[model samples]
Target: MSVKFRPLADRVLVEPIKAETKTASGIIIPDTAKEKPQEGTVVAVGPGKKDEPTTVQVGDKVLYGKYSGSELKLDGKDYLIVKESDLLGILG
Candidate 1:
């Protein structure tokens, strides 16, 4: 998972996790009805601001706001560049 792009100044590069396409009852969800996923894997992280180093690392699964980051596409893969503050929490 090597990326040519690197975030700067507290920004994080995240690869969004796709929303569930099927319900627990085996009902299939339509693409248009699917909600944007708030969970993602951290692909790249920027150095923290002065006196504060970034806590999240690459490959960390995290939760963020539904509309937190700017959308990006590289090599046909969707990504998000959000501020560290936009991230809600780290996922196990």
Candidate 2:
């Protein structure tokens, strides 16, 4: 709600949405055992660059590659500002 990002052109400032749960070895993971969320809220989005343009929006839920992009910490929380091409897909 109070997100401020000065993303470079053609890039998006995202707080990857974190999943609340995890499962492994055919067992459910407890909250304590669950891994840190790889996904998070979309903090800020940059203006699309290039002629064709990117379709991602500021509030759109998106999926990015596991090892994609750089990581940054804001207000003690982690965030990523990757290129629009880095986003894997938008959540429906």
Q: Whose lDDT is greatest here?
A: 1
Residues 1-92 of candidate 2 have per-residue lDDT tens digits of 66656776778778866655645556667777755544545667666676756677777887887777788987777788788887878887
Measured over all alpha carbons after superposition, the RMSD of each candidate to the real structure, in angstroms, is 0.8, 3.7
Candidate 2 minimal-lDDT segment of 10 residues: 34-43
lDDT of 1: 0.96
Model 1 TM-score, 2 decimals? 0.95
Clashes of each: 0, 6
Candidate 1: tens digits of C-alpha lDDT, residues 12-56: 999999899999999999999999999999999999899989999
**What 10-residue stretch in candidate 1 is worst by lDDT?**
2-11
Top-scoring candidate (TM-score): 1
